[model samples]
Target: MATTSPSERLLKTICGSCLILAPAVLLVGGLLHPEETTNAARQFEIIVANLGRWELAHWLIAASMLLMIGAVVGLAHLLHEHRPTEGIIGGATTMVGVMALFAIASAEAAIVPQIGRSGDAQLFASIVTSGGFWVLLGPVLLLPLGLIIMSYGMYRSRVAQTWVAGTVALGSAAFAVSLPTGSPVAFAIGLVLMFVGLARVGWSVLAETDEQWHHPPQMGAQLAG
Candidate 1:
């Protein structure tokens, strides 16, 4: 058992919570989402008219992305322990991507909802529904890019099992791929993969922490020495 700092334990907890809960909230929002097709104005009307309908999903999705940044950073800390001299560039890129993801999520959620508040039906209908290019492209590129970087760093760090690192990286890529495909089911799978991979890393760290708590390294070292 090895020692873990308080920051490490907290990071593991936050990352684990985000990994476990983000997807669940997103899934619920997806389920609660309106299933019918309507004109942009009509859709905007519904969204504005009933914030309750999709607000949870909106917040959850944004929050999840925000937390992902933490997850990346926390995982990086562990991976750094193994490969001190390698993977700095990848980690920095991933951090930038995560920041971009948060910004995108925040901007989109804020803007789209404003249409509702404005009560301009024509404007809502007339306005763009694409959520802007940056928002659209942010997750498609940034999120996966971060995860892949984290995965690479983890692999290089030798902190994670080969399969764990590989699966997580693959899952991140798969999720990113599904984003552009415009398929809800496929998107869900990607989210699942993101959650799965993150959960693996977070959980591993927590487990290690618990082991260290129960069996401190000093005790083992004393025995060995």
Candidate 2:
């Protein structure tokens, strides 16, 4: 049996915790998010009305993104022996997507409040319509794309159950759709499904024995033969 080093144990614990918590934080943020309308002026009004909640929610979302990045890395580490290519590519892509989301959340949490308080809906609308904004937002699509890729890899590797991987992919699609349409209900549902899938993964991670958790990738491959 492979001995578990302290560092390995610590990393494993952190990964499991992140998988369990990230989705919960995102779900809370989504639920707290105010509904939006097509009218920039009305959107501004809603923001101003729920300024504190809005800021808090976006901040939570940003935090969740950071945690998600860590979770992705952990998952990639686990998948390395089984599907190295997918693990590396999917983890990198997901990290990029999560970083883009963090940027958007930061703007909404820190910058949007100021804009809302100024009551200048025109400015907000203009910013939203700008090329720069779209450029920054474009990478958000990678989140769902990377998730699908990673989930498919997990399925192929038999690391994750079919239903679990499917749920993650489905949730990613729904969440991606919600982003463009600004649908809070859809966001909430997506988060719930994501939570279910990730929580199962987290549980599996936690259930690993010390020897299994610390097994070297090369050793894992040899044992599989």
Query: Which candidate leads in TM-score?
Result: 2
Report the C-alpha lDDT of model 1 over 50-123, residue by residue, as the tens digit.
76555566566667666656665556556554553334555566666656655655654676567677777676
The residue ranges of model 2 lying beyond 4 angstroms of the native Cα positions read 215-225
TM-score, one value per model: 0.71, 0.90
Scored by CA lDDT, what does every candidate get?
0.59, 0.80
Q: Which ten residues in a row are the worst by lDDT in model 2?
A: 216-225
Question: Per-residue CA lDDT of candidate 2, range 95-130, in tens?
Answer: 889999999999899999999888888898887666
Residue 102 in model 2: lDDT: 92
**10 residues in a row with least lDDT, candidate 1:** 216-225
